[model samples]
Target: MDIKIYVCHHKEGPFFENEFFKPIQVGRAIAKKQLGGMIGDDTGENISEKNDNWCELTAIYWIWKNTNHDFVGINHYRRYLNFAENSQNSTISLDKNIDFLLYCSQNIVNICRSYDIITSPLCKIHQISSPNNRQTAYENYSFNHFESDMKLVFSIIKEKHPEYYEASQISSGLDICFFGNMMLMRRDIFNKYCNFVFSVLFTLENIIDTSKYDYYQRRVYGFIAERLSNIFVLKQQLLGGDKKAYHAGQISLPTFTRTYDFSELNTKLGFVNHPAQTAIEILHGGTVHLVISFDDAYMLHAIACIMSILDRASVRDALTFHVIHDESLGSPNISIIKRIFINAKIHFYDVRNDRFPGLLPRNRPHISKNTYYRLIMQDYLPREVSRIIYSDLDTIFLDDIIQLWNISMDNAILAGCLDEGGLTQSRKLFGKTHNKNYINAGVLLFDIQAAKAKYGNLRFLYAESLAKHVRNITLQDQDLLNISFVDDIIHLPLRWNVGSRIYGNNELDYAYSEADEKIAAENPAVIHFTGENKPWHADSTHPLKSIYLHYQERASQALQHAQR
Candidate 1:
């Protein structure tokens, strides 16, 4: 059988396409720019303008009107049906290797011989219902959504197709549902399903007043279609006696999108508007880009961190510093930095307070919103630049950063040393089944080209993944980074980022052994003040406080000389 499955996307991002799987842009009518080579749903006969409420249905409608194939399927950009026999029951797992999980057209054709329709496994309605509630489809819909709108849908179905109204009633009474609107079936069956789904949704759209609804609730028609899909399936089951019976098969797939509560946030970040400015430019060989984010409060520490790099780096290595900071980092500080690093290229990005209007409630007291500055680099940095080394302001360099930068990425998105907390923190963020070694986000070597190709819009990816976890964020951006790039990070040696946590605790909680940890601690390449006990604080008990103080004196002398 000739089969084609369209993966629907809202924005441009990393995607996979084969002969059997193609990319389609949803909401293209309202999108600012069309994704390069993907087909837009706005072409041909489409209700593309109503995508906000229709959701992915707009793609289905376009396919129904424009394309003709033996079998057709609809999947999301980040979610797809797993056709492999060995992992049929796995859902919500990371799509580390999506290609392996997907089967070819011949395999799908073989499976279709026994089943008429292929889709996600049916989930209990209460599993997604409002809190403390276990209700049937109708009751759950009314609780979570506008009750009147749902009732209106049922009435429209009763008036338009009375036979299916009985099926709708039967479906509403049951506690099972088909979420996400993903499906694959014969052309005939698909035509019938789309006709039924859009008919009811169009009628509801005309009668309902959704102007007062919030952005989420405005997507009412899409939510209604999920329940209607259940009605269509139940109706098919009821009519089987007169026909060759339709057999629906289930395949569990990972879903990347989830709903997040942004009530605590003042304003959500939209798109990148401003680009970073280079304060001073220098040209040299083996140039390495180093990025660090901080506020005025960390000026002394940030200066010491940068000086340590200059002090220890080889003359053969060229350096470029990208400083992302808030408004408080005044011109005096900028002048001082330029005077001190005369041979290096200095780029400054002055972020407004409004850029980060709100912070996550679970963020630790020591960690601030400044940590999120690294996430916005994807939008503002020059495309020509392919790599960056991001470090925290609370760190001191013991070895040349160019050495860390020169190491092979080996196809990983970023490379970093194992976190001091080891798998204990990993188990807390993800479940105990997590196998990937969690790396400290403080010191990382980012492969910019590969990461942008793999996951577009780093800030958006971080925001979406952060909402999926239920744990209290011990490290705000660090938690989000691990969640986003769980399996795509490379583990560097312990010497790269030896944390203060190891020096303070009697029982070391590091991923490396005691012997390895001691060796790295004694002659560390970079010392990270991981916890609250920082070297700058008067009462800090960090064993490496003296080393930091030595750099602090050097940084102070450089600042004074620049004043001259």
Candidate 2:
């Protein structure tokens, strides 16, 4: 059987035209009459005069009223069914002039033979719950009086269609529900669904007071219909006699759009928007995990550090980045990082004062409280992530990080390169009894499971306790870590973390010999900008400062390019 799918559009843009797919301009009546010719006047649908309130469902209603094809489907101008691949992670752009629509046209008959309905992947509603403490899809509608309005919908269903009342209740209580109002089904079934849905919605239009709602919330009927679409399918399944089976499939929700911004998409994805906070995409199938902690002051350097890692690393897509930041770091910066490392998965954790209260003193300008975040990695990071490479923002990767990630800790709980100041400075600050091989906290490879077993939940407490004992320690968190994990520290080769001070100043006592310094200088996997002379500073005198400047310049250029 032949399939007919309408690509519902609002404004003028590039749209597809295959044997099966056609673009239909919706809201034709309310759209400016002068721009009608420009907005495909020849192929427009005549819906209600107030099409803005109905949103895209106006196009779905138009298709139901006009189309006579046996197999009918509805997708948005930006969204489409991802029939090219079976994987949920796969997405396609119809505007890219791809052959995916043609492929769908050829194979949809075979697909529909087995499945009765093809719907988009489930959209999850977060933190909203029913009275019984179960998650529900109802909270998303409760923005103004949307939830109260929905109660009227339930009452109507209970009064008019008593058989579907229970299913409607069950559908509202679900955490995951069908959304976007995008679906594919046989024409007869589509007609039955529309007949029942519009009858109830038309009745609601007479009763619900939408005068107080904003222009966006006035699109209440569309939102209500999306929830009701789930109920209709559930009701069919519950009262199964001749009703067809529902098959959940994937659809490509486009990220690149000319009409809307990422904020709209972010809100649709259920991201909580704090002031200047935005969402980052986390892709599936990550093999390597990395974590970093910084404030807004270090965001540029952190981006450069990540850029250097991506530039030098052989396997980029396998990596996942976990960033811990305070409120100072904005969403635009995170979005910039996402655009640069488009394939890699990036997750952001907002650092709160309550999580680690009293970890830092009140008047410490020399060291930031943000550095202490790495100490509590076990608490924030996902339990499945047992191993993570934590690095400071002032570092650059010269070799593949996958090499350092593969290093074996053996019996040790964590691994790090020895501090440039060595055990003598450690003893001077933390006392001889607390000193061993002092490892720099700038770069650390944590075998988290082993660390948890050895220290239990007392790692953070011990670090806090050690900070109390050593009040004069300059390294702050680093000194606390050395004193805490004194016996379990594993020393890595000098090449893993080569500090700039190791080459410039001979006054400080370094643990490595001249030969080790020469090897690290020649072939370093990571170059650490230790001490006060950072490359970004105008007065920096480090020999390898240009390496950082190169990445910093590239990061700037990438941000500029993305904004365009």
Candidate 3:
């Protein structure tokens, strides 16, 4: 029983190379041509260019369409199936060691002799609010626009492969399904699964509006495919005998880290004081503290968001900005941010070396890990700070900051504009009907002391929840915040955070109507570019695109002046 597992990689990394495993580069056709000889090509009989949409599954397609092996398997660049004894619960973190490779090369074939297919541990999506009513795997996908897509998938299956439709439906409702899309199976089973998944995904490609989705959400097809793999297995079991599969435990390894490495800076930079220990010497009686989180890549956007705040804020001089960032952000970017708001007290918090663990998850390529920074703000902000406004990098302030700061929390822990999209999808996501008002995390006014009192040691609680229920956290920090503070939330007015989704024809179900749209346009206190089309992108259709550019241009000029 010789097993060949192809480990997929997009960029160079310290992947293990041995007789059992081969490193294959996915999306090689559209990738830089210079990498032809250096990386494995996924061009012939492949969907290489759609890496953004297909993710690691493109490599799976390559393996199925091109490869000839007795037994085959697929794993990601960072994630792999752990085959070590008693290691079923833990993933093999491969560093500079080849022991993991040796163990897999030796044991994989033996394990396959007993099990027809080997898959990663089942991730169970349980009920969020009620213990009696647990959510199904189908319900989980439904939350992210997959409900309609799966309906189409089931219809196709029912029309074509009627025999498998009943089993597929049963599997869909079963909350436990193989996750990570990493599996080891015999060539025949692998071929069947591949044929089913790719066919369905290709059909979806032709039918679904891929162009309307943002870069992150466009990967819906891949997500659907992940669930389908389990459905395929379930179908086989229903037809064949039971116990045809084995659940193998896997581990997550840190594939890469982004670090600031600019050699031109004159000052030696390091982590400053801890948020808990840092004294609030700069705080005045009525000073408005604002917090924003982003990585170096989004420095320009963060600058624009801050600039917009400064431009419209009546209490400009009284505003103090706290930037939560990674160390990879160069000194030049930090200097430029300070230059943009020279009048405001700009403090930087480098979370690179912070002790908080598991706050960051396996984020999509587009989402920065810095997003998790907001969850740990309770531990990082000065104790003197009673209340603060936290905003996302994509937000632009359209009205005075004082208005947002003055909204009474009314005994609530936090206040934010209700998420129009979240409200519509609340039942599917949270399983609650009475509280349809889910506030967006993009723009929030945190009542610091109240929030701390409600959720004690937020960093610890967040880290614990993130580690245990990461799969449950579909929307990342937004989902975590909503789930954690579901009851103690105050819904602000829609105009406070008018998102771009409200205007487009592919608008969410809960989008503002024409009357509300006009009101938002006339009195939008904050404009959020929530969809895939951002103001920075060339194809941006945001009504307030010019405003973002206006601030961006000024930010660029300010940076140029600092450089000169």
CA deviation > 4 Å runs, candidate 2? 1-286, 353-358, 362-366, 434-436
Residue 520 displacement (Å), model 2: 0.7
Candidate 2: residue 464 Cα off by (Å): 5.3
lDDT, residue 366, model 1: 74
Q: Best candidate, TM-score-wise?
A: 3
- Tens digits of per-residue lDDT, candidate 3, 432-496, equal 23255677889998887887787777766666656655555556787677766778788777788
lDDT of each: 0.72, 0.70, 0.71
* Superposition TM-score, candidate 1 onto the true structure: 0.49
| C-alpha RMSD in Å of predicted model 2 compared with the true structure | 22.1
Residues 1-564, model 2: lDDT tens digits: 768777777765566767667777777766764233223323444454657888777777777776688888777766776554353324343334455566545556666786666677665653211122223677545532357779999988998878778888888777877677778888888898888788888889999988977655688898888888888888775654355654444444333322323244224322133232122232222367899987667867887899878766666776889987776677887777778778778998876754563445423464577787787767788889888889998998877777777777877877899887775455444432324488888888887787888778856556566656444455667766776777888988888898876646433455666677767766677889988778999999766777788788877887788667
lDDT of 1 by residue, 246-293 (tens): 323333233322122222111221112312222232222256888887
Segments of candidate 3 deviating more than 4 angstroms: 1-285, 355-359, 432-434, 467-469, 511-518
Candidate 2 lDDT score relative to the true structure: 0.70
Q: After superposition, how far is residue 558 of candidate 1 from its true place, in Å?
A: 2.6
